[model samples]
Structures are given as structure tokens and as C-alpha cells.
Target: MRVDAFDFELPQELIALRPAVPRDAARMLHVKGGVIEDRMVLELPDLLDEHDVLVFNDTRVIPAQLEGRRGEAKVGVTLHKREGLRQWWAFVRNAKRVRDGDTVEFGGGVEATALRRGDDGAVLFEFLGDEPVELLLERAGTMPLPPYIASKRGTDERDREDYQTMFAKEDGAVAAPTASLHFTDRLVEAIDAKGIGRETLTLHVGAGTFLPVKADDTADHKMHSEWGRIDAATAERLNAAREKGGRLIAVGTTALRLIESAADEDGVIQPFEGDTDIFITPGYRFRAVGGLMTNFHLPKSTLFMLVSALMGLDTMKAAYAHAIAERYRFYSYGDSSLLIP
Candidate 1:
């Protein structure tokens, strides 16, 4: 399908620069079949049933943005994927000045050498020390905010806590699973009290998630790989929930994609550990995930395409129109929507 079909006009003021206070105070638009209801994140417990399972991505966002100097030239790097313990694939700004084998010196004595360039225009950087790269980043990096927000303002101490979710434990993601950001301990307790089961999996959302789709057609757009893992025990528990007639509610699109990638034709989820570039578009049939709770996405973005696939394209368009008209916030720090097909 044409990528233009997913395009919509969004007012500049609608983009959220900061998250709602208390997290659960964020607005949530419930899209059940064709019905739409405006609600708050705190009301999520009432929307689910005792037999439903909510799957959350436990991957934590890292300080992936680095500002460095290669000789006299300034280099901006956003680490997208981990190639090794000390090596990462990064999208570099001022790429023309950064050649392969050039040492980019970040502040506080941290440095990484450009090893090679990937086919997707990203540069491979190998850290030059024996200490863990995570430690190096702690000294020389900042949180990797989405460009939509970053372009408007600078990242600050507040974003360190705001960009991460309560489920954050395993560290690897460059981008936050925005949908999970709306969850708080209070909400989790409420859901648990309501008898809704919660499960967790890891999907290190990369900076590639922020990349724009420049293709005219959906078939031509390529998704950068993101590493994810679903252990056997979790898979078994999810299968058990399904056997008991419990619906699997993916907390975010990252969880939804990872589960769908691991599901078989029979709709059984299996243990998985690896990279997935699963590009979900219209006409794709979902198997493992029954419902999705996610943030509002950009125009012509893969996320919008995935939501369109979940609900019909026309349905999603109408839903988005309703969201815009209702003045719900948009983007990573924005409001959320519960999409049930």
C-alpha cells in the first residue's frame, strides 16, 4: 500500500514535550471494535477482565546519545544496536567527516573508533577501553530522547526518570517503550487486585524506531533489527493463560511485535531470543497478541501502519481523527490508546 495513505495532519502544539504528572493521569482513548471511549490510564483496570494477561517490555532505556569530536569535526552519535560488549551500531550526524577507523573522543576521556559503516548508513563504533561501555556512557552520554521532543528542547534530569517505565529492569534499549511509561505501581496493584495477570519480556527498543519511513510504498521500507528475548518459562505461562481462555494484551507495540514474531500459525507463542525486523503493515494477520495499548504515533510511521493493521486502516484513521479533535497529547511523552480489534 502507498505510505501516503497513512499520512495525517497534526497540529504542532499537539506534540507533547513532557509527560503527564503521576504517569497514570495521562489520557487513554479506548478503541473497542468501532466504539471509542475517552478515559484515563488509571481506569485501565476496569477495562480488562480477570482472565486477561498484560504483557510488558521490561527493557530499560539507556543513555545512548553521545556528543564527541573526531579531530576538529564534531560528531553526534545515537547507539542503535549492540554488536558486542564494547561495540555498537550508531547513527552519526556529520557522517561525511567521520571516516572508518577514526577515533571519536567523547568528554571525560571516553572514546570509540569508527570500525565500519552499515548498509543502512549507520556507523559501527568499537569502544577503546576494557571497562564496560555502560559505565563509559554514564560519564559521557545523555538520554536518547525522540527527535520530535529533542528538536524542540534539550534533555534534562527530569527526562532521566520520565523516559523510563516502572517495568524497566533489564538495560539495553535506546528508546523507551512509550506505552509502558503510563504505568505506575499504583496502576499495577490495581490491576493485580482486579485479578489481571501481568507478564514481562525484553525487547531493547533501538534508536532505529525513531527513523522516518522515506519510502513511497510500504513494501520498500526496511526496519532496522531490534534484539528481544522471551524465555521458555514466560512462553509456557503465556500459553497457559491462553489455554484458560485469557486474552493476551500487549502493553506496547514492542511487546506486540516480539510476541507476534514468536507465535506459530496455531497462535501458540514459543521461546525466542534474537533480532527481529518484523515490519507489520496492513493485510498482515496477527496471531499471538489480542489487544494493544500504545502511544500515538507519527504520520506515515511503521507504528501507525501496525495499528492500522490491527484495526482496519479506515478505522485507525477515524480513531486518530477523534484523538486529535479531543486534544489528546501525542508522541513518546504523549497520551495513549487501547486498541482492541
Candidate 2:
């Protein structure tokens, strides 16, 4: 399919610079059976049954955005994937000034030597110290905000808390699973009280999520791999829930992708621990996930393509049109959508 088929005009002002104050106060658009309904995030628990299970991504966002100097030239890099305890693959802002083996010195005693550049244009860098890279990032890095928001306003202390979800625990992701950001303690309690089952898996969202689809056709686009894990116990529980006639609703695209990667042709999920470059496009058959709850995505993005695949392209286009007309916020800090096909 042509990539332009997924393109839509979005007004600049529709992009959300900040998340809703109470988080749960954010609006949600419910799309089911070709119908669109306006809803609120707080009303999520009422929309599903006690037998339904909500799958969440527990990957914590690390402070991966770093600014440094390679000799006289200024360099900025966002660590996207962990290659080792001290090695990371990062997208460099000043690639022209960096060369393999060149050391970039970030402030607060943090520095790394560029090992090589990948075909996707990400540079591999090995941190030059014995201390953990997480500690080094704590002293030097800031939250890696999506470029749509960061380009409008600078990242601040508020973003440190706002950008992360309440379920954040395992540290590795450079980007937060935005769909989970709308969840709060109150909301979770409500969901639990309603008997909606909840489970979590880890998928370290990389900066590749922010990359645009420059390809003219969907087949020409390549998705960068992100590391994810689903233990045997969790897989068993998820399977059990489904066997009991419970619908498995994935909380975000990251969770949806990981679970789908773990599912067999029969739709039974298995234990998985590896990198997944699962590019979901139209005509793809969804194996395990029954539904998805995710934030609105960018035009011509892979996320949009995934959502289009979930709910037909025409249906999503109409839903998005309604969202835009209704003035719902957009992007990582935007409104939510519950897609049920």
C-alpha cells in the first residue's frame, strides 16, 4: 500500500504540549464495530468486562537525551537501545562531526566513544567508565521527550514525572508508552474494583518510534528493532485468561507488538525474550491481541499504520477526522483511543 494512503492533515495547534492535568481527565475516543463514541479516560473501566485483561508495558523510560561536545563541535544524542551494560545505540544529531572511534564528552564526567554507525544511521557508543550507564545518564541526561513536544517547548522538571507512567519499573526504554501515561492510581483502583485483570511486560521503546516513514510505499519502510521480554509465567497467565473467554486488551502499541511477536499461528502466546522488529501494516493478521488502547499517532507513521491495520484504514481515517473535529489533543501527550475490531 502507498504510504500516502495513511496521510491526513492535522492542524498544528491540535498537538498537545502537556498532558491533561489529572491525566485521567483526558478524552478518549472509543472505536468499535465501525462506530465512534466520545469518552473519557476515567470511564475506561466501565467500557470493559471483568473477564477482560488489560496488558501493560512496564518498561521504564530512562533519561536518554544527552548533549555533549566532540572537540569543538556540539553533539546531541538520544540513546535508543542497550547493546551491553555500558554500550548503547544512539541517533546522533551531529553525525557529520562524529567519526568512528571519536570520543564525545558529555558533562558530569560522562563520555563515550563511538564504535560504529549502523545502516539505519544510529551510532553505537560504548560508555567510557566502570560505573553503570544508568548512573551516568542520571548525572547528565534528561528525559527523552518526543520531538513533536520537545520541538515546541524545552523539557523541564515537570516532564520528569509527567512523561513516565505509574507502571514504570524496568528501566531501559528511551520513550514512554504514552497510552499508559493516562493511567493513574485512582484509575487502576477503579479498574481493579471492576474486576478487570491487569498484567505487565517489558518493551524498551526506542527513539525509532519517533522516526518518520520516508518511504513512498509501506513495503519500502524498515522498522528498527526494539528489545522486549515476556516471561513464561506471564505468558501462561495471559493464555489462561484468554482460555477463560477473557479479551486481552493491549494498553499500547509496544505491548501489542510484543504480545503479537510472542503469539504462534494458533494465537497461543509463548515465552519470549529478544528483539522484535515487527512491522504491522494493513492485511496483517492479528494473532493474540483482541483490542488496543493507544494515543493518537503521527501522519504516515508506523503507529498509524498499525492502528489502520487493527481497524480498517477507512474506519481509522473517519475516527481521526472526528477526533480532529472534536478538538481532542494529539501525539504522545494527546488524547486516548480504544480500538476494538
Candidate 3:
């Protein structure tokens, strides 16, 4: 399909620079059976039943945005993937100034030498000291905000807590699973009281999520791989819930992708631990997840394509039109949508 088919006009002011206070205060648009409804994120518990299970991505967003200097030339780095305990593949700004084997010095004395360059134009850097890369990042890095928001304003201390969900635990992701950012402790308690089961899996969201689809056609686009894991026990539990006629509600596209990658043709989820480059587009069959709760995506983005697949393309376009006219926010810090095909 032509990528241009997914394009839509969005007013610049609709993009959210900051998240709604209390997290759950964000707006939610419910799309089910070709019908759209306006609602609030706090009302999610009312939309779900006791037999439904919500799967969340527990991968924590790391402080992956870094600033450094390569012989007086300023360099910006956003770590995308972990190659080893001390080695990472990062997309560098002003990359031409730093060659393979060049050392870049970051804040707090943290330094790394570029081991090589990846085919995708990313630099492979190996941290130079015994201190774990995680520690070095904590000392010298800032939260990796989505380029849409970061481009409008500078990142600050508020984003540190706002970008992270209450379920964050495993540390690896460079980007936050934006859908999960709307969750709060109060919302969790409410959902639990309503007898809805919640489970978590890890998918270290990479900076590739922010990359645009420059391809003219969907077939020409290649999705960047991200590491994810689902254990046997969790898989078994999810299968059991489904056996009892429970619907699997994925909390974000990341969770939806990982769960779909772990499921078989029969829709039975299996234990998985590897990288997934699953590119969901229209005409794709969804086997594991039945419903998705996610943020409104950008025009011509892979995420929009996924949502279009879940619902009909025309239906999503109408839904998005309503969202825009209603003055709902957009992007990572934007409003939420509950999609049920």
C-alpha cells in the first residue's frame, strides 16, 4: 500500500508538550465496532470487564540521551540498542565529526570509544571504564524524550518522572511506552477492584520508534528490531485467562507487538526471549491481542498503520478526525485511545 494513504493534516498546536496532571487526567477516545466515543483515561476501569486482562510493558526507560564532545566538536547521542554489557549502538548527531575508533567524552568523566559504525549510520560505542554503562548513563545522561516534544522545548526534571509509568522496573528502553504513561496507582487499584487482571512483559523500546517512514510504499520500509522477553509462567497465565474467555487487552503497541510475536497461529502465546522486528501493517492478522490502548500517533507513522490494521483504515481516519476537532492532544505526551476491532 502507498504510505501516502496514511497521511493526515495535524495542526501544530495539537501536539502535547507536557503530560496531563495525575496521568489519568488525559483524554481517551474509545473506538469499537466502527463507533467512536469520547472519554477520560480515568474511566478505563468502566470500559473493561472482570474477564479481561491488560498486558503492560514493564521495560523501564533509561536515560539514553547523551551530550559529549569529540575534540571540541559537539556531539549528541541517543543509545538505541545494547550490544553488550558495556557496548551500545547509538544514533549520533553531528556523526560525521566522529570517526570509527574516535573517543567521545561525556559529562561526569564518562567516555566511550567508537568501535565501529553500523550499516544504518549508527555508531557502536564501548564504554571505556569498569563502571557499568547504566551507572555512567545515570551520571551523564538525560531522559530520551520523543523528538516531537524535545524539538519544541528543552527536557527538564519533570519529564524524568512524567515519562515513566508506575509499572517500570526492568531497565533498557530508550523510549517510554507512551500508552503506559497514563496509568497511575489509583487507576491500578480501581482496575484491580473491578477484577481485571494485569500482567507485564519487557520490550526495550529503542529510538527507532521516533524514526519516520521515508519510504514511498509500506513494503519498502524496514522496521528496526527491539529486544523483548516473555517467560513461560506469564505465557501460561495469559493462555489460561484466554481459555476462560478473557480478552487480552494490550496496554501499548509495544506490548501488542511483543505478545503477537510470542503467539502461535492458534493464538496461544509462548515463552519468548529475543529481538522482534515485527512490522504490523494493514492486511496483517492479529493472533494474540484483541484490544489495544495506545496514544494517538503521528501521520504516516508505523504506529498509525498498526492502529489502522486493528480498526479499518477509514474508521481510524474518522476517529482521528474527531480527536483533532475535539482538541485532544497528540504524540507521546498526548491523549489515549482504546481500540477494539
Which consecutive 10 residues in model 2 have the weakest lDDT in total?
Answer: 129-138
* Worst 10 contiguous positions by lDDT, candidate 3: 126-135
lDDT score, candidate 3:
0.95
Q: Write the per-residue lDDT of candidate 3 for residues 1-341, one digit (tens) a residue.
A: 99999999999999999999979999999999798999999999999889999999999989999999999999999999999999999999999999988999997999999999988999999999899888999999999999989989999999899999889999999999999999989999999999999999999999999899999999999999999999999999999999999999999999999999999999999999999999999999999798999999999999999999999899999999999999999989999999999
Model 1, stretches more than 4 Å misplaced?
none
- lDDT for every model? 0.95, 0.96, 0.95
**Candidate 2 lDDT, tens digit per residue, 169-197?**
99999999999999999999999999999
List candidate 3 segments past 4 Å from native: none
lDDT of 1: 0.95
- Candidate 1 lDDT trough over 10 residues, lowest sum: 129-138
- In model 3, pairs of residues that clash are none
Query: Across residues 1-341, which tens digit of lDDT does each residue of candidate 1 receive?
Result: 99999999999999999999989999999999999989999999999989999999999989999999998999999999999989999999999999998999999989999999999999999999888899999899999999999999999999999999999999899999999999988999999999999999999999989889999999999888999999999999999999999999999999999999999999999999999999999999998888999999999999999999999999999999999999999999999999999
TM-score of 2: 0.99
By lDDT, the best candidate is 2
